[model samples]
Target: MAASPAKKRILVGQSGGPTAAINSSLAGVVAGAREAGAETVGMRYGIQGYLAGRTVALGEALPDDDALALLRRTPSSWLGSCRFKLPALDAPEAEGFFADAFAKLEADGFDAVLYIGGNDSMDTIAKLGAWGARMGSPIRFIGVPKTIDDDLVGIDHTPGYGSAARFVATAVSEVARDADVYDLKSVTFVEIMGRDAGWLAGSACLAGPDLVLLPEVTLDEDALIERISVLLEHQNTVVVAMSEGVRGADGHLIAEKTVAAGTGVDEFGHLAQLSGPSRYLAGVAKARLGVKTRAVELSTLQRCASHCASEVDLDEAFELGRRGVSAALAGESVRMCTLTRTGDEPYAAEYGTVDVLEVANKVKPVPREWICADGMGVTDDFRRYVAPLAGTLPQQLKGL
Candidate 1:
């Protein structure tokens, strides 16, 4: 009797930053691969570790249903992560790097390599897929999108965004109430993450922040101060949700002063230090408006708050992971799994694939029409588009 085809083997890795639902995707990959009668291996720290021969067998690391269930709710990258950028397919350095990486994959009989990450990570998949094609290799490369930034193109929204949006909305809502409790005039500035896109900062609209500042709209410092001064006159507390990436009319980051001295850019050339936007705004508000000012930077908490994760986000994230395995098994390559929004009435989404090359190194900015004419708030259309994915916030008690 002819021997059955050998079990398919695939390697997976996580890269870029971690998110609350990133592991849910990892769990789905592991569970799906096992159920498909395939062997699964994980990179300890994404491609960086894989290049160094650091890997773990998923069958041994996660043995059963219980492990996967727990992983779905686990916050952060389960297999560690990295931000290593790969050399261009045509670059001289690429000759050796690709040769070594492909040699390793071929030696281990890997049918595919799946990467879970954001824009930068997708770029890696694009390069690998291109290299494999050039060398006539059979191994496939796939990207399962994950990012709180929600900046990736070709997808309705990314997996980690919903959970992070949930956290931002919940935290801002709670903080708004706390800021108002003292019966004193105050301005609370909340700084949220978003380097080139303001999707995360725009989420603050779900919590009813008085003002929302986004990177898409340049900040007019004088106008902002005047607005806050006006807001303080009418309310006990004025809460503003600001994106750390917001820039001035001169096209420079308002939080530039906060960047640590001598901290260079990353492999992707993104600034390494991104904080203090809220503090700078708060100080300005306090000095100009003469009101109590408080600055709160959500920092890493937004991406790591598993307890605040949205069920919609986690479910979709996991399914996308499984989809990656199926795609690889089907001989698909250089593709990134995507979520297409099918309906808005009750909120629905369907999984699909887009060329990784189309998605890599791309940023999807919040639509201009979604922002208010004054650029201080989001429109009803924006709310409708994001509300379902982020889930509903709990009703809070109102003090009479």
Candidate 2:
């Protein structure tokens, strides 16, 4: 009897929180996998879904042109998402989980897997790939980067961060312009998202040299009040940018401690709540600084504003996904697709693969050198790092 042809199957999943460019990465992965003669499959939700034996054909799930186009423009994860943290490889349950998952993949004829997500998601890829290699399972795994936090190490910046930063800077600049025109005695505090790192808030510094407040600086609350008082006394309007992760002298998240604890909890037992630092600061300004205050939480808008996405970020994200597929086809396993800055002048990126273990679950903080001494702004170097990511400036709009 003649030998049978080997099954060629590829599995792709979204593993972390969504971003504006996540779907672009997905599109690239789908297009590349199909071109490489592999039957592409999508794991519903994420690794958890794989463990539970839930999956669908990529062609059926994503459909054709119009749906794929919508996927490209959609902000959040279209396949849905979860924050299930995989247990450490050394844990007792880890081996059993891997055995069962790989058995399922092998039975289902999956030869490769690609996970699109941020640091933690890459960790999942590393774990599964390493286990598969050790077990001699013929499955290759690749990781595609995605995060608005911009904290993933080794890469120049995560895909979603550029678009989010662009949105933040634009909104902050517009708020500043609005404040400049108003004669009403009020203080506006704009709060941005950044869990532990301050990348999102730091981007607000790009609005202008003097318009941002960063967590990197140990801010004096009294001094801030005085400054706002002075601004309101003289100009009748003041706009301030703040990070949700801003820490006090004790190093606690100002917003985390102040926000009202939500009654809800997810599967991870993490609190489901919004940061309250901006609202808290607004109250303080109104009470102590004797100025009317307004708070604007630029929460989900930062991550989901596909309409305001940075073209550079989108292109890079898609390229990263294609490269990830290529690397997997080349037999690269336990690796993440990375884009490193080759030059700052013309904004060049060199795509390559790095050990996912090296980049997984570890955060890269905003450089101290990039923070201004007063702790209220970023230096020119920080701006240089982010400016090119925004691509060309948008045309200015005139009142009709």
Instruction: Report, for every candidate in turn, its global Cα lDDT versus the true structure.
Output: 0.92, 0.80
After superposition, candidate 1 runs with Cα above 4 Å error: 397-400
Strongest candidate by lDDT: 1
Model 2 agreement with the true structure over 1-400: per-residue lDDT tens digits? 9997765788888977789999888888887776776678887888888678678788877767677667777788866676777767889999887778888888888778999998778888888888888888778989999999898998899999889888888888787777667567888889998776778888877676244666666567787887777666667777788888777767766776676655465544434664888888899889996767888898888887887799898888888887888898888988999998998898898999889989986888888889877677778898899888866445551122
Off by over 4 Å in 2: 1-7, 62-70, 230-234, 262-271, 397-400
Worst 10 residues of 1 by lDDT: 391-400
How do all models score by TM-score? 0.98, 0.92
**Residue 301 lDDT in candidate 1:** 93
Candidate 1 per-residue lDDT, tens place, 84-196, comes to 99998778898999999999999988999999999999999999999999999999999999999999999999999999999999999889988988989999999999999
